[model samples]
Target: MISSLRKDADIIIKKSIDAVLPDEAVKRALKGFKKGTGKVVLVAAGKAAWQMANAAVKEMPDISEGIVVTKYDHVKGNIPGITCCEAGHPVPDENSFSATRKALDLVRPLGEDDTVLFLLSGGGSALFESPLIPGEELQDITKQLLACGADIVEINTIRKRLSGVKGGRFAEVAAPAKVYSIVLSDILGDPLDMIASGPAVPDTSTCQQAQEIAARYNLKLSDEARNLLGKETPKELSNVTSVITGSVRELCTAASNAAKDLGYEPIILTDMLSCEAKDAGSFLASIAISNSRKGDKKLAFIAGGETVVHLKGTGKGGRNQELALSAAIGLNGLSNAAVFSVGSDGTDGPTDAAGGYADGETVSDLKEKGLNINLYLDNNDAYNALKAVDGLIITGPTGTNVNDVSVLLIS
Candidate 1:
């Protein structure tokens, strides 16, 4: 059963990522740009930024010059022509700010004869932060929104107003240069304006919307942020073209296909799944148990979306880790079943571990170590709890980000 579960999980992970590989997305989006008609300047930002940029270079060798900003550890092998830089994520740092400025400079000189291929995916918000608000203020608001358990969309809505280069402003900055955005969406429903705060898309959200979100979350913003939100979106940027080539639905389809290939009947639980991480974990486990009780010979259930973690403790872990741990607690001693949850990017939250995987025996294994699940969870230490029970899944970095993928199998 362990071997079977491992195999199934591996297949699911690989297939899910393959569905959103940035290179394929880029190739598809670039069809609109006539070859040799203009200089192609590629700009990408996210955890998958490097891989996406590398793929673009491979697909369009004539790309004159490119700039890519990715998370520190996400930088892949060197690409000769593209300038690659590492930045911070989930929170902006000096490097991220520097990269954003450089990217702006690189794109600002573009003429109507040039084209900008913008590759955007998850984590771009933090990897490139050019705050219209003061840097310190933006950082403070970001920390507050995260702590308040705001969803990705809500947080990004607020982020767009606080930034100088987000919410289609990047496209605006390179005005008259035809913009083509290829996106790997991490948000539910794949809203073009939410992914990476829509660097090259239209701004559907106004400053009022951002202000309301901040107020609703009781997020304190600097005076500069407040002032910026009052300003109007520039008019010249409305012509930018955006396309979403990857999303949670694509990942769910991949997982379903993998399950079918493994001889299991696949059921997609939901593509828009969202809630507190722990609750999602418990709900999925209950559904898994119910399906197992139905006497199905082979069953697989898949779900995708970003789940939020309300941090009360200083423990190390991510939303995926918490979900896996919570599922383990709910599963207890249920037989012939296994559950796994992983961030598609292969790093969950601040932890080095990708996520967690567990079987029926997970509870027993934890008990043997005298670990208290509730305490660990309260302390936000899901990583250690799962690690102690040999349930942690460590994939380092997967170079793709669609969101989180959860799978349950009964055999």
Candidate 2:
């Protein structure tokens, strides 16, 4: 039963991944959009940039040119006619600044008869960036915001303030050129203004809101960052149009289908799940435990959304990994349960692994090796802890990002 449960867990997770492939989602969204006869240019960013650009070019063979800025290694060989650039993610590095500058160059000179297809997805806030302040200052503030566990919306509110292209500034700069955005949402509720920091759309976030977010995290910003917080982003852009191509809901539906195929009664707890990493993990484990107590075999509870991690220790793990590790303790001796957490983008945090997974005996197995799970959880070291237990799930770059999915199973 344990082996079958593990197999079923793998199937469910794979189904979730297959549902959000950037290429397929882009093609679906393109079908509903009216592609004008203008000189079409493609500007794709985030983890799925390459896949989306390739798909768009295929759909519109008349595209004049294309530029793709994606995380390093996300680009598979290359596509003819498209300039592919690999950049930083979660944190913008020197290459990120360089690549985004070129992307901006491609669109800034467009005529009203020209159209810029902005294939925006999660991680664009870092993968495509042109800093308003010094790059070093932006980097420092980014680190602060990340470690402080401010949610994505709060982080982006401040990020839009510091960026030259974010928060609809890209559309503002490309004025006269019609901008059409195909967005694969990585944020909850599909807030069009927050996905990829809303590069081509109007930003509703104000400088005042950004300042408040900084204060909430007690982040120390440079004077330039502080001054820029009061400035408004491009709150209105007449040249931009947007369409949401994918989201966490799709992930949830696919997982549910997979669960049914495996004879499990799947319940989608929430796609809007937002909380601290550890809390989510423990809470999911508790649900699994409750089901197990009721003799509810073949049951799965799933959630999808991004969670924040307040870094209290120097650790190497993302929220997904931390979540699975935290669940390890709660699921310690329940021989019939398993909990897995994975980032749909196929990469979590700075690690190459997508996320982590654990079974009921995880904690006991760790103890037999003389390791304390609590110590690792406390240190935010889920990567190493899960590594020791062979719990890490490494899928490489999935060519997509639609936030995260955590599955709790009891069978």
Candidate 3:
């Protein structure tokens, strides 16, 4: 039944998401933390800042003081001990600068015997910020990084150079105090230095790498920004320890198990899935098509990672939406096939939609309404196109960010 398959798909995806909630991951990581006798301060930054901070406070209610900075509207309520501040995301705003200053100040007063629990997660690179240059220039550079096809590692290489507190500089600010950073990684391989631009970890990247990235992308930076990027960030930190508590691997494993329970043979194609979003979608569709040729029934193929989208068009859509749209085009003539892509954070770019879903009939449905799928893809308008076909998957704020997940179901 079509309805049954759709329900099964939803179940699999939900399992993936539930396995990576920031609260659960933080709570697990807290078991390893030894309570400090001196002042304990918490600094949480990312899209999941509120959830992570709430979990930390729940685990250790004795936090002396704290600050939580997240994207606007991500902070749902007040934590009794922590000051919650909403800031800009995907691009740093003036609020981002102010909140980051407050966070830095919170660390500056720490004693040698004190402890700073830094809860880091995805989107922190934008939500947590202290630019060496003006806010306007930082925003411009961030926009360039997002619009270009450069990966997280590359973007962060440039960012750490321009930040006052990134690339282990935050740890330096909290010097003589122990900084415990529990991180939920949204980047592939769970690279600590790439996640949130490695605020609490040492910079393994060099000024040459930053310069190369800007040059490769043809990114125009201000004179001050250029100078900063050529300089080095902190390369060592003795007081910081980082632990990756969650990542895409966990999300993929959960999806695999859920699909198996639903009587679908699940294959975790890759956890390191990256590349352009559209190309990745097409490749997944190809795999589905190959399996379908074998007359296999009830197969679930999944891939997880963040993909980049080089913006050639000003159209509104996130990488996940673009992925699903591209998959829909590739699976146009395939019967009993469905493809979906979702951001674990429950948002795709600037759109409210988490991502998208398309069945075998999606192309036909669009055709019947005189919609051109190729045109939408070329314009990078997947959000609008998928909305027209009722293909947008809108899940508001999952309170976590592991990465993106792509699923293909065949019967």
User: Per-residue alpha-carbon lDDT of model 3 for 276-341, expressed as tens digits?
Assistant: 999988987887678766764689998988898988887899999999999987787777778889
Clashing pairs in 1: none
Give the alpha-carbon lDDT of every model: 0.83, 0.88, 0.88
| Model 2: per-residue Cα lDDT over 1-411, one tens digit each | 667777887788888898789888888888766655568888999998998898888888888888999999999877768999998878899999999999888888888888888899999999989999999889888999889989999989999989999988989887798888899999999999899898888888887788888888888887878889989887677887789988999998888888988888889999998999899999988887777877745788989998889898887999999999998878978888998989998998999889999888889888888889999988989999899888898989988899999999888
Assess the local accuracy of residue 274 in candidate 1 as a C-alpha lDDT between 0 and 100.
91
Could you tally the backbone clashes for each prediction? 0, 0, 0
State the lDDT of candidate 1 residue by residue for 1-411, as single tens digits. Answer: 766776778777777777766777667776765642668888889999998888888888988888899998898789869899998878888888998898889888988878888889899999978987667777778888888899988898888877888887888888878887888888899888889988887778777777788788787766767777777664346547777777888888888998898888998989888999999889878987787677747888888888999989999899999998898877778777788898889889977888888777887888889988888999989999999988888888888898988888887
Question: Model 3, residue 307: what's the lDDT?
Answer: 90
Compute the lDDT for candidate 2.
0.88
RMSD of each: 1.7, 1.1, 1.2
**Over 4 Å off in model 2, which ranges?**
35-37
Say what the RMSD of model 1 is: 1.7
State the lDDT at 204 in candidate 1. 82
Model 3, runs deviating above 4 Å: none
lDDT of 2 at 383: 95
